[model samples]
Target: MRVAFVSFETVHHRESETNRRLQTILELLSEQGHDVHVCCAQFWDGERSTIKRTGISYHRASAGLEAPTSFLARVPFVLAKLGPDVVHASVRPPKQALAARWGGMLARAPTILEWYGDGGITNDWWTRRAARWADWIVVPSELVETWVRELGVDEATVEVVPNPIDVDRIDGVSPGDSVDVVYARRLDADANLESLFLALAELRTRDWRAVIVGDGPEREAYEQLAGELRIDDRVTFAGACSLEERLAIYRGAHVFAQTAEHCVFPTEMLWALAAGCVGIVEYHADSSAHELVEGWDRGFRTTSEEELVDAILEAGGLARRDTDDRFASYDAGAVRDRYLTIYRTLQDSSSLV
Candidate 1:
């Protein structure tokens, strides 16, 4: 099958969850003999507009900030020439979703839109228009599925497929102390890092340290909060690290802590769990991330601050169990095959009718 992905950001241009996910998918699809083309923007200098990597073709969108808009404008032309069977997009960028809808129509192909947000955008004029225009909607969790349905998307057009984690890419290395806790994610209030830092402070009685990975707008505030709690010396604000470096950190840690207030299933959590940190942390009351580790016996879960502290202490002390059983369904190949199922279904002439 010929597939053209309409993305504002490419893996080479940006290092993000979407970039990583798309790279995995496109590479796998290309390896499987599918003609995969990624229409995206170039992030750095001397970057060619069209480059091929691992059998996938990447066509740079534009030279300006309005690249996504300009790229969408050319999707029809590109699709006309490439004549792909499917056009993939996302709803995060309202403009890209809207444009992909129009481009798919121009190319007479089915456009699949991944809606990762919990809020229903169906009521918003532009979002609703894009949602209506999208041929099929793919969401990661049931929570998001319900939201998209409430937004007036056709029920038959929506499907739930969790994102994939490159299990082989992660390192399952837990330190001997087992009190080495790590928080790997963007530093945002929504992440509930305030609660995490406070909980870490409470656990100061133990000989433990924390490695906070990733950088975001809340960096300064989190740093200040750590000082106020007097646990600054025990924590390391590592900022962001490369994927290999991140996996190594997760492996060396005994526990991975996450405190999200509201979030779709985070890809970071999946990678951490895969890398063998006896994951600990309660799912935010309003978050869908809880679903990721709901039944896994390899980690811990809690809701309140007290429970979080207790879980951390308990899980940190416990020996690492075989995490293979927990990540059975999330294997990179298995998840990619599930997506392949969707693509094949859409490609079937009967499904269109």
Candidate 2:
């Protein structure tokens, strides 16, 4: 199948869950012998119209690009020319994804609109219209599924597909040499790193070190909070990391604690779990962390700062458990197969028409 993946930006920002998902999907699709093309708003070194990574033909069009008559720009010409069997896009703020969705219509291909951020996700007029227009809405969590349903899209058209975990790349490693708790997320209010700091403060007397990965606007504040809590000596701030560093950090850590207040789908947490870190997450009703860690002994859910501290303590000493058997359904191969089947179904439907 020939497929066009329309994204805001995948090459420039690789750490983001959206980018990660796009890369994984494209690679797996290419491996499965599908002709895949990537159309992003931004590409390598800001260069436009170049193919990169896994033989994907890359194209670009500014979301804000317009004609002088004040008419909105039609779908990207490159995408329309490709005329893919299916046009998939990641919908988010900045309205560019909606533009790409329009481009899919111009390309005359069935579109699968992707949106993963769900908690506190509000739709505007254009978003609602795009939701109605797309052939299908692919959401990563039940929370996101709810957000799309709130837009009044037909229930049948909304599919809750969890983001696939590359289990092969995340196989459990032997326990590290020393005990170190790990927290990997963009440091921001939503991440609620303060909770992790507070929890760590309680464990200051314990023999453990923490490596906080990822960077954001709240990094300074989180650092300040850590100093105030006097755990700065024990915590190392490792800013925006490469895929190799992140994988190593998760695999080497004894505990991986996530303290987000409202995470739709915690990608870092999932990776940590798959890498055999005894997982602990601050519980929230809206977080997909709850959904992933539910009924699993390797993961513990905490309600408050005290519970988080206790869970961390328990997680630190936990032995590596075989999680592959438990999370097999989320294996990248399984998810790739599911997507292939979906694409085939769409193609078959179009042929029938």
Candidate 3:
């Protein structure tokens, strides 16, 4: 299959959850021998209009990120010329998705917009129009699907596609020294580390050690809070870790905590669960993290610091496992096939029309 991805910016421009997801899908498609192309403002340095990297092709829709109108103006033509089997786009810079929709129309291909519901301008008129104009809208969770439906888009047009994880990679990594608890996410304002810290403080008398595996501007503040709670010695703040390092830690950990105040999809929690750690998600209105643990035996959903503490303690009785095969469906290959199925179904329906 030939797929064209339309985004005003990409991982090369800035690292973000949306960009990472797009990059992963593109790489997965490329690995599966599908011809993949990305249309966006040039992020690579040079006057060249196109470049090929790691088996994927990138075509410049504009001179640079400074020119949004130009990017929107040229994307359709670029995609039409590429003539992909399908056009998949990110829902940021809403105009770009609209442009991709136009491109899909020109090329007689289906267009799908992926809505991450992360930090971005999503409440504008352009977003609603893009949601309605695209042939399909893909969201990471039902929480996001509901938000998209609220935009006046038909419920049938929105699909819930969970973020993909690398189960094979998790299985290949060796477990590190064991720890009783693990919390991993960028220590930003919404990290909500305080909840987990307070829960740990409540159980200070117990014999347990926890590790916070991420780094951000708020790391020092969280560390200070840990000290204020007098649990600093027991909680290890291991700064941002690589994929393998994190997998190893998750494998060795007994429980993984998800306390972030906002999450469209709990990517790290999925990783931890696949690594065989008992999942403990603190409910948040704006977060869909709890969806991952629903109906799962090894997962626990908590609403308060007290519940978090209780869940962690309850997780201790579960047998330790090096890996869990339950999440194998979330593997990159499986998720790639899901995208392919959607594309083929759309292609057939469009043909019938």
For every candidate, C-alpha RMSD to the true structure in Å: 3.6, 3.9, 1.1
Assess every candidate by TM-score. Answer: 0.82, 0.81, 0.98
User: Please, what are the lDDT tens digits per residue for candidate 3 over residues 165-271?
Assistant: 98878878999989999999999999999999999999999999999999999999999999999999999999989999999999999999999999989999899
As a whole number from 0 to 100, the lDDT of residue 324 in candidate 3 is 93
Candidate 2 vs candidate 3: the lDDT winner is: 3
Clash pairs (backbone) in predicted model 2: none
Q: TM-score of predicted model 3?
A: 0.98
Per-residue lDDT of 217 in model 2: 94
Name the 10 consecutive residues with the lowest summed lDDT in model 1: 170-179
Clashing pairs in 3: none
lDDT of 1: 0.74
Candidate 1 per-residue lDDT over residues 1-353, each given as its tens digit: 88898777765766655566567778778877888987766554675778787898877676644556676677567666667788888675667877776777677777888776744344577777777787788887877887788778889999877777766555343323333788887887676788888888888877888888999999999999999999999988989888777777776677788787776666777777776777775766556667776777766778888988988878866776324447757877887788778877877843456
lDDT of 2 at 47: 45
Displacement of residue 306 (Cα, Å) in model 3 is 1.8
lDDT of 2 by residue, 110-156 (tens): 77877777435677786788788777877778877877899898999
